[model samples]
Target: MHGHYRETAECPGQTRGESSGGTHLQMHGHYRETAECPGQTRGESSGGTRLQMHGHYRETAECPGQTRGESSGGTRLQIHGHYRETAECPGQTRGEREGRVVDGLTSKYMDTIERLQSVQARLEVKAQTLERESNECRVQTEECQQQLRKCQSELNRQVKQSSCVIQEKVPFNDTKTSDYNSLNVPPHNKRHQLKARDVAGQALGFVQDIVVALLNFHSYTEQRVHIYPLDSSIEPISPLNQKFSQYLHENAAYVRPLEEGLVQLHQSITEDTVTVLETVGKLKDFAEHFTSYTHFLQKILPYQLKSLEEECRAPLCTSSLISKNQELQSGMKRITSVFDKLHRYIILLALPSVRQDAMPQSSSSAVFTQLAACLHSLHDAIKEMSKHYSQKAGLEQQLPTVTQKLCTTNECLLASLGMLTNSTDKIATFFSNNLDFFTSSTGYGPRGGVGVLNPLQAESMLGNKKKASDYMQAIRKPRAESVPYREALLNRRVLTSSTESRQGLTQQVVASQEKIARLEQEKEHWLLETQLGRVRLEKESQRIQDLETQLSSALEGGGGSPASALSLGLGSPALTSLDDGELEERGVEKDAMINTSLVGMLTTTPTNEEVRDEESREQLIKTHYMARVGELTTQLQVSDSKAVNFHAECRALAKRLALAEKSRETLTEEVKLANQNITRLQDELATTKRSYKEQLSMMSDHLCSMNETLSKQREEIDILKLSGKGNSKLLKKGR
Candidate 1:
């Protein structure tokens, strides 16, 4: 068997030698044929020769044709000799040539397997790194979401608290009390009450005097008749008299209306005086109610809120709510103070008996002065009426026009007085609205509601309602010319107030938009970072897949032992050198045992068991890499999805923010325009007030001059009557 094995191995070697020599001879013959061809150039011949040499070198390197010590020329000669011997030997088999080809392919496959294993190891390390990074990114995302939720909750809480506070603070009622007690003035000392009563009595007396004077003037004017006859020589003799007669004729049409207006003025003043007296009586009761309400706010509401907060411990149980409650209390105190000042102003204006030494000049004083001016004008008109009836200075026509103007001025003053009284109604409304705050169980009051008005206080409230109704009725009544003026003023005020409200709303919208914008920007940044992380994870996954593909290719191509594949060129330089030494030693041993083992090594296709083992190991490695790649891919996909969701949310928030910003900008512009309108209205109001004051001053001056002229005329009439009486007695004696 040994002799047969040796012969078989020798036969294959001799066959390989013959095949290599025959191939070389064919190459040389082809080169010679190319060189000898008529169509072949020198460059083509040289190129063909070089190509043959390169092929020979590659063949020798892949499957050694001769010993390493042999020169190229000697090796060729030996190869030719061996080829002659191999052709004559006649014992070579085809299987031997196939085995040699398979061995060469297996060696090349081993190199590829080594490279694939190395790549696989690197991919695994990279995948592990990516996994760690992805985990970190996930943790960061979770943390960010947690923070966002916390911030949102906090903002909502703050908004709720602010809205609640604003609702509690805004007063919605408009009530005014003329009585000092109604304004919560302390009545412990009767001195203030006595003072108030004295002031009211004095104001009533003044109103009575004005009423009496107006009535007398009306009766006197109604009785006066100017009869124009051809008998009297009462012609306008001088230029001044002619001018006065012209004015009298021009203003004659106003006489009847002036008389009617004066009657209405007297009636209105009388009614206003009665209303004031009635309001005075209720002031003490209103004051007591207001005091109780303030006490409830300052003492009861806080205590209730504290108890509720202690019980609930909700988000509403914050210091800010307490602070707002305190602010409300302070505002109530301020309202009380303003009410007191207003009450004192009313007293000063109404009561001439009250000491005016300490009374500061204020709007009330201006109103009083204007009222006095109206009375003075009415007194001058009465004197002018008397002068007209006497037919002295031809001033009857002028008197009617001046009297009409005086009556109009008095009407304006009465309207102003009504407004002044109505102005105090705001204090009552403020008190009522504030008192209502305690009525709400969820707002400032306890479970058992407080701040409610008692039945005893209902009587005082009835007066307020009556007064308001009366005032409203008065307003509803038709005033021929004043209606348009009042409407214009009201429209202007409404425009200004609406503009102010719009501005406030705009500011709130702007602030909300800014908050939304900040949130959106933060969300966008987080999404961008997450997307980058996902991209990194995907890149790692792709690398892992690439490594897996290479590993699979190596496993398919290399049918070598797994140990050889794993250990081949995949270590530190020292380890690689040691592996090289071992491989060389194994090669020497294999060469020495070639005669015995060549057939076994070459003819033995890897045993099914070994092949299966290698394939399974390769599969295991591939599966491991693929599993890692899959895990990374899954992580990438999950991260990508998360990033996508975050991006979508960010985009939505951005859109909302942009809308809010646009709204805020529009509102801001509106606010600016509203402010401008308000300024313009204020300027107009100031101008009107100034012009009215000037007209009043000019009329007052004219009234003083008219009063002086009437006194002189009355003296002249008395002098003329005494002289006529003396002349009549003498004439009687003469008769």
Candidate 2:
């Protein structure tokens, strides 16, 4: 029979043998020598070959080649070549060589298979580790994207709100000038006067009352009027009252002088008609001068008084007061000159006439003297009036310093207020600039590029306009669109999260499938190993049966030696039964021992209970797994609910954003309307101011025209008076 043997120096306890006669054997430790194989020294001689084969196997196992198929084929070829060389000796038969080659091929094939399995296991482990890392990377990427979206949304919202607030805060300053203009117009018309005819008529009426009173006095006293007090009620009072009373007493005493002067005038008139006419002409001239004087007083004095009062009350500048004082002094000089002319005219009229009248000389002389005295009193009254005006002017002069101080204080206050307003405006501008900086610095659209909006950009877009409502509306339109844009972005984020979750779930399922596949492969490998062990055990049993049959055959042929017989009979039942008592004793002993061992086993190894415990543990594990699954399901449901709530909140936020956008739009529209109204009002104010200016110009032109006309009329009157004088002189010369 041909046999193959394997020897491993590293594992001395294990041995394998294969026979061409259909006997395959495996052994552990040293094998006992059998009598049939006493001459065979094959085991010792094959040890070197077995050591070589083990070294080859070790080499193949330690340094695995990249290509399994090629390496295995090459190793098989090398083993076949080694076996062929070993079998190629001259004395070797073809059968042994073929069996050796077949054995070497089988050994090499087993090594290749083991190497492939180990390589596959390592690859599977690496693949699982890589998949886990990839899943972690995916989760981190998703988290980062979500964070980015949140930051972007928050930034956009803040920018929009800031822009809205900025749009809401712009100011208008044209109304103040209009108010000031309206307040200053009344003082100009306050100084205008009534017509000259009306003033002259009033003066004429006053003259007529005076003339009637004088005539009544002359008739009642029979051309003699007493200068004393008429009643006890008359008394010295205030200076103004005392002056008037003294004038009345003096007028009463002067009535006699006036009668005497009138008697002298009557005698002159009776003596010569020419003299009478000349005297009448002189009286007419005096009347004309007095009437002119009264007209001047009535028409001009009140305006001058009002002007002086206004100047005194007003807080005019020092330079203006000084100019006004000079004007007043000049006017007083003019008035004093007119009074002196009237005084000379009065004295000339009071002189004794060239021709005497028919009346008493004494009465005429008394009348002339009384009239002169009355004229002197009138001159004194004029001087007093001038003095009163001078005193008023002086009083007004004293207030110039106070008025100047007040003006300076007012100017300083106005300047301070202006400075404060300017400073506040500058502070607002600084804050606005800061806001613009923040707005501009914030990133918006994409890839950290330029921002969506900034205050400076908005202002620039609005083109330096005072009103930015239109620009705000334009901005709002885009911002309104951002609501939907943000919603879409949120939806996309949700979808991406769901997709990532699904990918994670799929990855988990794939990992689980890989684990299940690896477990199934392990189970199949274990079952194959168990089947190989069972087949090896059965082969060994068959080999032992064959050995027993051969021994029996040798004994039956009567060729077996006694020793061989003894050796064979060692396993026979008859020999074993011959010592029954001792065997029985031993058997009893064995049975007792076995029984004790069984009892010990029964006591020590509670297999059923252990199995029950294991099953309970499994049940507990299953229950725990189920509870975990339930918790996870509940968590998933809660997460879904949270997602739904988040979606609802996002929707609500979107609605609020939309409402805010609408409100912003409304505010922008209102602002636009307000801007339009302000512009319209400014235009109206401008037009009104232009009209007022034009009206003032027209009034000034008309006043100048009226002044020129009055001057021309006065010049014409003077010319006419000169012509009348010349004509009268010519007429008098012709007569």
Candidate 3:
């Protein structure tokens, strides 16, 4: 070793150097650079730490006092040429594989979130449909309930019709007979169309057709209210048919032929009973028509009056009753009020002869039987009066002028009837108007709620997706501290917040699951409500169908038999016990022992001995009529009870419908809240994964960078060794 390999050391700590042929190497303090043979190059750094390149881009660096067991920024790594082991550090490999696993988990989680969002969208739609259907059902239920109420009112009116017949026309005490078999009549008069046997516990008039209410002709009453009580019986103003009773007492001979021809002139009483009974049923139906109309007024008027008073008191009310100036005697309110009071007072005037003491609630058979007995008594009275009038023989001579007088009085009665019909129509129209006003003033729908969410409900669910994705993907690989080879990057700090974030994510998942279970319960409840409503609707529809059938038969004149019209009148007489007085006498209405089934037999039968005796024949006739009256009275009591129960069922169904709709609305709200929570949880989970992934990615990058730097230094060391060997040979040759 001579001057050719001599050291003019420019390196740190007096390091060795070589410059031979075209190769030169120099080191300065802690920095070194080399140029070896045309294109070869090297670098070195040494201070408190050592950094060196050994061969083919291999590198190593170690701090002072660092040992083989510990890490000191030293790693073995290099890029091989054609085929060799790849440049990879243990830390980077472990970190990169784990990061990939984390990435896969993130992708799976995001997929789950997207799927959950779609499911929530579908649930929202389903909830909306249920809300819509329930609303529609509620609306329909309201309408049906109103219609059913109206129909029920009408049906009740049908049951308690024609109170006037029971209240007056026949005196009850005069018709009463204690002994039916006193004038013993045997079962002897068995004709072709009529039977002689009288069935026990059956009304005489109901079983055997005899002249009944129909045989009593329409009579002109003395009282008249031009607009109001032409056909009605009101107290003090327009008591019905009073003049007819007076006429019968006063001018008995003038109108006697009509009754005598029908009742007395029949070929045989039993043979002609069918014709008489059919006519009586129809006459009863027509009489009941007017009476039911009065009853309708009784029901509707008070309600309308209450409504008028309520309307007058309501906020922003413009009712005519509210204006004192318009409520004079000439006003509509005054007129209607008078009509209302008079209609209610009509019962008081219907019988001026001790009406409270009078037995009123007689059935069809009872009415007919009582009328028959009274007519028989009257027949005897007419004959007795004729005996008195026959003494004064001018009664036959005065017939022509009497006929003219009777005709004039009949014309006046007809005129009053025309006026009564017009007034009744007006009152009905007024009552309907009040009903409309009351319904409008109240927000009267049964189902009440606005629970369904709008279409924009989904807007807040997927909150700021762009911002979320950016946070999730934001990452730069990390770097080690104070390394000279590569630029330092921000080292990921210890994940202190990770534990808290993990716990928070777990809580979110648990909360979402709990909400899901609650959603399940609510959804089941909603579905059950829907099912119940559907079932109730079907039942209501069936009830309406039966009503339609009954109404149609009545309207079509009762299906074509002679008894058809008769049945329509006698069939299913409504007993409106809920509102109107179903029975005129409460004690009489409780006929618990009454048989509904009609036994078609007369109570009394005339023997030859009884028929021959005039007083016995009359007594036998009276007993038959009284027995029939008692039986019919018993039957009327039974009908009134059944009608009361049917109405109660309708009310309960309506309440259930309202309850079902409210439950459905609550379920919809719960589902909406659950969907919101799920979306929030999805966002939170995505955020957590992004934070964890970013931290892990940074750590992998830092380890990879360190490993790569060490590999390059090792490669540099190999190249420097080859240059030193060549220089040593050149130095020897030069020596």
Candidate 4:
């Protein structure tokens, strides 16, 4: 045992493999402590540097006291990716005459293989480092490319501005025929005029680009105003608060004063809390309600939501599913509306709004339960479908991008989550463990990507998904553009890209000078700010002195004096921003207030040294020069444009005069034709008058004839009358 050395590197790695066994034996032959391996295979440690091996776990055993102590991590060894288990050490290891039992050829071959493997490993390590560097370079390259893009955009903008300037300087009529004009315009003016027109189109596009950027900036500010607040729960005039107070007022039919809104809010909160608790307290068990529709929560609701499945199972159709989800959302809204009031006291994590919910007894647990059931059902469904939906099929259809939960770095869909999305919240609840990552929408699933479904917007979004193809539009369609970003604001992406732009380096000399001036002003402002802070600090010190005096007097007076004298009259320091020794003392004083008479005696405040700091800061911003620069640029552009207009106007006016003369000549001809038409019409009118008079005379002659005939008839009638009288006499005689 004293003359033997055995190689065992079984924990995970090996250096030189079995090939160097012969070499090892030759080297240790003279050393009495070296022992030949029973298997005639062992390698000298490869520079004694540990190498990590990645492969299936393999075991090789070495007896105690036989090893030279070169071991991986266990009493085992492997050679050339081959594992072999050795028995307990042979008792005759010392007596064994190793007369080259291992053939030199085989030993040499193994040694060669091991050397190659070692070389390969080193190469692999080198490759890994190279790959890491490559990735870093690639990232830097991408950043450079982005900066290049911004540079290009800015360059395009400058070109467009120059074009616009030239276009403005060279006046041209928009209505002028663009085909060809050789009247009064020379070729030089015409060439510039043509360039202006041609470049104006590109300028217009550049202007649109700038406008879009401005709009995006405007929206960014809007989002900051609405969402980027640490204390968002305390908005006095928030719409939700207004709605709460308004609802309270309407509920009791009382128009209370604005100052009492907080009192009203507290009353409402108390009433709602007590009502919800009482409603739940009366219930002996929640098992019955959990079961009534628990199955749907699992098997139907969430599955349909994730898939936007229209063809429902036996019990639920699309319409019923939609209606149920709407009802569920309504319940959730109510629950959130009630419990959301508690966020005022919750110091750690809280959403601006929770999108909370409830079930019968209206307990939040039921809401939570139903959400769990839906997710469990969805997950189970996924598992079942995963059985049938082959990986090959998934790859071919590109389904994982559309269906799998996002923000997971792992390749396999629905298999394992790399991390929880709500790790920031760190909240423990009934469903925290089992249901945290239940579904895509609820709990700790990816909520930010383009196709991510929000639990609050699930109903409308799913409905839209079923009926429409525009999922991004549907997901983003919220009341405020910022509404879609609210949860993201709370649960933001932890990893952020570094920002840089090429635009700064490309600024004009004026802009650079302006920036220099701005920095100088900022330096002055900071100096002034320090002075102001000193004044405020002095005022705080004065207030502290007064409080100390009041406290001392209170201690001296004891319980015998008035309550006013007993008051400690402590007021917190006004200058919280300063981090100097005095402010640290102030902070220490605040900490000291934690234990004593400092609590109740906080009424007194020193005279406020600054009331208009915000306004003062605004006034100090020195943007007038920047604006003046723009105005001067505009005026220069206008002045140049006016001079260009004089020349352009002369030619244009000359052309217009020619056109006007031609128009006037045409008008004279038209007037002559119109007069001829009028004279012809008058002659026709006279003929018509004469014809009318002739017809009237003819009609009168015909009337005279008609009168004479009537008279003749009258005379005949008289004759008849005389005959009738004779006839009547004859008739009387006959009678």
Candidate 5:
């Protein structure tokens, strides 16, 4: 049964044999495997094998006599009862010592076990603490997560609220701001415009009020006044006048002579006022006539009138209509009143002169003079009025022609433009339809369209059209004849004024010419003096140049002396003591004289070139003298300063030498101290070297002791090996 069981357990490829006697059996196979034995199944054998294995996976036979399986590596093995089997095993006493040693080892092992148990207890406590910390950390983590969630939710809420608020407020803010801005902007602009308009309107109203007030004042002041020139060769009534040709012929007053004179004066004022009133009346009639004519023309010819209507409205009719109108005015009434007032003022101012002249000049002459002035003024005013009338007539005659010409020209221009437009359109059509023909040879492809041009053809067409247009345009509108009329009026006024001024200035020029002649004579005197001064300046300049040359040579010479240079007048005795004080005084006096002379010469009105030359010469002379004095003063100052600085430097050098000597003594003491410190450091270095050598000797002794201990350990190891060999031999014998 055993053979059958063994055969069944061992497969064909396994090597198997029976060993020993019937009480013991040994089976071998290629490898380990679970198989059925005599009464055991493969499963039961596997279970029995497992039961035989210890907790450490050490396999021991379940049979009491069976040996345990051995695993071999580098470690030593000890049998249970062969404590003394090793060659180095101790005798009984030595065994006792070894037992004691083992006892110590056991105690050490127990201590290690205790330490391990204590370490395990501590680790368990620590683990409990770590677990608590982990739980707390987990709790903190949960709290942090909760806080993070809350923060996230809060942030989201805040973001959403902010978004909502911003969404709501942004438009509201923008709308409100826009509303505010618009409110401010429109009103501000409107207010500014209103202010400007109000100011302008107020200014216009003020100007109109002033003009109306002036007109009213003149009308009121002139209403009661009347005056006329007296006839000469009549007996004078006023004692103050003392004139044979003048008489007071006032019908209202027959009083004392003074009172009679006053009455005459008052009558004359009244006459002058009456004259002004008549002039104003004529001005008003003229204005009204023009205003009526303009109003009639504007009313009748609402648009432009035809030539027939203009021709039928004769010049006299238009003139009469304008003269009869009420608003065709240039404020002439106000001007006439102002002129009358001016005349009265002049008369009053001339009264004293008139009285004085009466003693010699006859009263008739005085009256004639005044009447002549009045007639002259009246003639000037009448001439101005005639010129204005002629200007108006001329303008009236040319206006229709200008307007007709403008209309005809505009129609012609429109026609020309229409023709040009048609030509352009035809050209454009040609280009668009036959684009290839214009640019077939050019690399630009079809370019006859409006955008593209055959350069020469386009240029020729444009040039021809431009030339024709320019030539046609050159047939200018007939130059407005009113321009010449205005020029003629201006020329007439100028000629009249020139004649009047020429006549008045004729007598006055004689006295003026004599005065000019005397001035010219005085100018000749100054001219002579200036010429002499220029000559002297030239001589002085030559002397200065000579002195400069001599001084330069003296400076260049090897052995020239200052005295020799002075003898040559390069260093004048007069200039030797001239410092800034004297130079400033001289400059001031010279400048004053120059200014006075320059003013006199300028007032004399010298010719342009003469003035230029004199200015250049004066500037050159002043610059030259001033530069010469400045150079001399600078040289003197530089030499004196050098001398002074040299003395100061000498004293400073003496003081510095004493200080340097004291510093050298201090350096000597520092060097001695450094030498002593060096000596102390050298001694300390020697002592340190000695101590290092002693410590090295002690380390060498320790190494020798360690070598002796290693030698003893080697012998003990050899003994152990020999003992191991004996044990192997005993085992072989036993086998």
Candidate 6:
């Protein structure tokens, strides 16, 4: 077994041919040894050798050159086939065959091993190619994913940028619109009016832009915005323009009424204040007069008192007691009179001043003058009282001492009234200052400019314009020759309000009347419309009743079909719900009955009694038909007239069109001619210019030529003269 393993191990490392050769060599060696042996001479030795070789060959064929030890190791089993045939082994046919068999087995085994190795190599190469392909696919997939990510990011960025752009532009456009809406100031000055017109145009442009943007937006909100007309004012402000609308809404309450009321109140109060100032002036006058009267009375009093004393010393004061009593009584009367007059004067002074201060400015002039006159009268009365008081004072010295008391009361009352006037003046001054403040704040600038009487001045100008127009109208009147100009002027006064107070009242009345008239006109218009509507409704109702009667008759007759019934029921509201079958039967019956009734009615028409009735009915029907025909004829006539007029108008229009066309043609021809003329003129002008330039150049050349010729001639002349002189000198020399 060890020798077999060594032989198999060597056989595995060596080619089959080499191993077979070695086996032949071994067999040959064995045969040589055996041939030399005694067993070779004997037949027993040959049989044993042959059997042994045969066994070995069978084993080699079975295991394919595998020895026992080589099989046990089982790792280095690779071999190639090697054939052996033999002359070296003389009696070794079995060994040689065994070697051939082993060689065939080994060759078969080697072929299988080579095939398996080739399959393994092919599989490994396929796996390597698959791995490389898979890796490349993965890299490409990763690259595609990166590109997708980059595209997604760029798309997102563009989306965000587009959204931002839309947002910015949308708000900017809305803000511009809001600015326009807020600043809808009135146009006063020419520049402002132009600016306002420009703003309106700009606003329209913005609106158009907004409309376009909304269309582009393609959103529900934008679609809804478009449902309303762009020019519609009723829509609420857009989100972007809300700020200005909100501002207008929030501040509207604060501004409008207060400003208007303040203006009106300022004008009213200023007038009142002016009245108060005039009243104060009146009071001042009264007070001055009162003071003067008091002085005059003081000077006149003594003389009047002495005269009273002298008069009292008559027969009525004969006895000493009677005369003295009478004197005392007379003195008391005088003092009482003086006191009464002084009290009356003081009261009058106080009241006139108070009234003057309280009177309305418009009435102030009259009131002031009246108060002044009353004060003057009171002053005279006070002078009379002072005279009586002075007389009483003289009498008091003689009889009683009470006159001085009366004089003191008069002085106190006069002084008190004087103080009252001073107070009024102060009050007037305060009011005047307040009026100035008020005028500046509310009455001037916006309402009327600059001065207190600006409104009045404007009114007066308007009045003058009216008067001038009236005067012109009067002068233009053919019959005005009978009416004096002054009379006409006087009559014109009636057309205007006489007083400021009356004028204001009349203005309010006129305004109220105008409002009432407008309302009445609207009411009358509505009433007329209502009446017309009612008349149409009544006519419709009557026609409906007649139709209903006819429908009822048809339904009752019940002969004809529902369609006929329905035809009879035309204009009838009463038979609206009649079903088809019922209506049909009713219509048939109604048609038959109507036909018979018409026949009977016609039968009566041929008889004398019926003839009259038939004639009247025929006349009525004929009249109605004639009236209808007349109406139709009138309508036809009207239509024909209209057509004629229209035809004439069309002819006129055609004439005008022809004229316009002719004008246009003329204008076109003129324009063409003008263009031709312009071209011709341009060409002529150019040619003339060229010609002029050529002529100028030619003239210049001619002048230059002439100048050159003249110079040459002069040079020739000089040369000739020189030559002559030289020749003469030569001649002289020769001589």
Best by lDDT: 6
lDDT of 1 by residue, 1-735 (tens): 223223324334445454456456655566657744759887887686666656654555555445433433454776677568658856755577578889999999999999999999999999999999999999999999999999999999999998888779855322232232232211122343343344434333333333333333323222221111110144423333233233334332322333333333333332223222222333333234334433322433333333323323323233543443344344334433443443343444433212222232234335444434433333333333333223321222233333443344334333333332222222233223333221222121111332322223334554554577688799999878755888999998999999999999999999999999999977755554444335435655786686567556665678666555545423435345566578679546643543243211322347553354345444544665698799999999999999999999999999999999999999999997797567546755775798799999999999999999999999999999999999999999999
True-vs-predicted CA distance for residue 14, candidate 6, Å: 99
What would the per-residue lDDT of candidate 2 be over residues 75-128, giving only the tens digit for each residue?
A: 455556555655676576557868998999999999999999999999999999
| Model 2, residue 524: C-alpha shift (Å) | 20
Put down candidate 5 lDDT per residue, 1-735, tens digits, no spaces.
Answer: 343333323323222222121112111210123321345676776555444323112211122233222211101232222323433554445457568889999999999999999999999999999999999999999999999999999999999999999998776542234222221111012333343344333333322322333233222212211110111133322222222112122211211222223233333322112111111122232233323333322332211122123323444345443442212132233334334543443343333222322122123244334433443443344334334434443444444433443334333333333332232332233334433322222221111211222222322433444565577678864776565888999999999999999988986898899999999978855665566467546765886797788787876673667666665543556567776599679757754555466522522347553466467656755665588799999999999999999989999998899888888888887886676456435544654676687778777788788888888889899999999999999999999
Summed over model 3, clashes come to: 33
Answer with 1 or 2, whichever has the higher lDDT: 1
The C-alpha lDDT values of all candidates are: 0.48, 0.47, 0.39, 0.40, 0.44, 0.49
Across 1-735, the per-residue lDDT of candidate 3 in tens digits comes to: 122122212112222311221112112211322221223333222221122222211211223233432211121111121013222432445467678889999999999999999999999999999999999999999999999999999878865564555567545532133221111211222342242112111122221111221122123322211112122332332222333334333322323332333232233234323222211222232233324433433443343334335434544343332443123212323334443443333322222122222323223234333333433333333333233223212332233333444345444544433333222332233334333321221111111211111112112211332344456567543555664433322222224466678899999999999999999977755554444335435654786687667666776864666455445534544422232253435313422211121122211236442233334334544665687788887787666666666677667777887887888888888886686456435645665687689988998898899889888888888788888988999999999
Q: Write the per-residue lDDT of candidate 6 for residues 266-321, one digit (tens) a residue.
A: 33322112221211223344344434434333433343333334435533333443
Q: Which stretches of model 6 miss by more than 4 angstroms?
A: 1-621, 624-628, 644-670, 729-735
> What TM-score do all the candidates reach, one by one?
0.18, 0.19, 0.15, 0.13, 0.13, 0.17
Q: Tens-digit lDDT track for model 4 on 1-735?
A: 112122333322333443255234334432322233343323433221112111112212333432333443222333311222113333445434443445666799999999999999999999999999999999999999999999999999999998998798967642243221212111122333343333333223322332333233223322222321111344533443333333323321111121133223223322112111211221212222222223322332232232222212213234544454444344333323322322211211112112222222223344445543443333333333333323322332343322222212113322311111111111122234534222112221122211212334433433443344355557776775553676665444432211122344446666989989999977765665554445445666887788678777776766544544433332334433454587679657743542232212322334333334333333433343466688999999999999999989999999999999999999999996687456435644665687689988888888888888889899889999999998999999999
Residue 49, candidate 4: C-alpha displacement in angstroms: 99
The local distance difference test score of model 5 is 0.44
Indicate whether candidate 5 or candidate 6 has the larger TM-score: 6
Which runs in model 4 stand beyond 4 Å of their true positions?
1-644, 727-735
**Deviation from native of the Cα of residue 112 in model 6, angstroms:** 99
Candidate 3, residue 137: lDDT: 98
For residue 234, model 3's alpha carbon misses the true position, in angstroms, by 90
RMSD of each: 69.8, 72.5, 57.2, 58.1, 54.9, 60.0
Clashes of each: 11, 18, 33, 12, 16, 17
